[model samples]
Target: MPKKDQGLGPSAETPLPGDDTVVCGVVRHLGGDYLLAKCMDGVDRKVRIPGKLRKRVWINEGDIILVGLWDFSPDKGEVVYKYGRNEINKLIEKGFLSKEFINALSEYL
Candidate 1:
């Protein structure tokens, strides 16, 4: 059978479609103790990248990043692959995200 399309990139600070299996979306909203994000699989999942990610990287909203995949019940997505500041910067420079919103998964390179 042919493989299903992964869909278009996150244009306009949209959540990533959970499919890459390895990649995960960046922080779309951060308020509560944990952060809310749309995973690469397109699943909006909660992540824990506060202490480390926050301090290390200036994680603004809408950042397409690689993340570690974690499973715990029917609802839950944890951050496993945390990119550093430099990497995050590269993502920004790539311009896959919105400059204004600065929140998106990917864009046509």
Candidate 2:
């Protein structure tokens, strides 16, 4: 058996903001399973990490995440996806993110 070669690029598909309900955000603060995320829409929302992803995903402050907004609460949302460094670069190249935002986010990284 031969070992598979893994490249430095993103291995899986990088999910984009699919619709109006999904938005891109930056994790600002982490408190247990909930975190304060600054959304691109200019709203600061309290986002929760669902039980399914709680143990599987290790979310941290300063990470770029996809948030699914709640219909009942405008200020609340749930973490749908987290972007890696390579994925973030791909997003920037695709014109989904601005360089200024990446520059600001670099402070946290």
Question: Which numbered prediction scores highest in TM-score against the true structure?
Answer: 2
- lDDT per residue (tens digit) for residues 1-109 in model 1: 9966543322344233244334555556556535666654457676666454454455555555555455544345555444544554655576543343334443311
**TM-scores, in order shown?**
0.45, 0.76
Q: lDDT tens digits, residues 51-74, model 2?
A: 867876777777888888888898
> Which structure among the candidates has the greatest lDDT?
2
RMSD of candidate 2 to true structure, Å: 5.4
Clashes of each: 13, 0
Off by over 4 Å in 2: 1-11, 21-27, 105-109
Question: What lDDT score goes with residue 63 in model 1?
Answer: 52
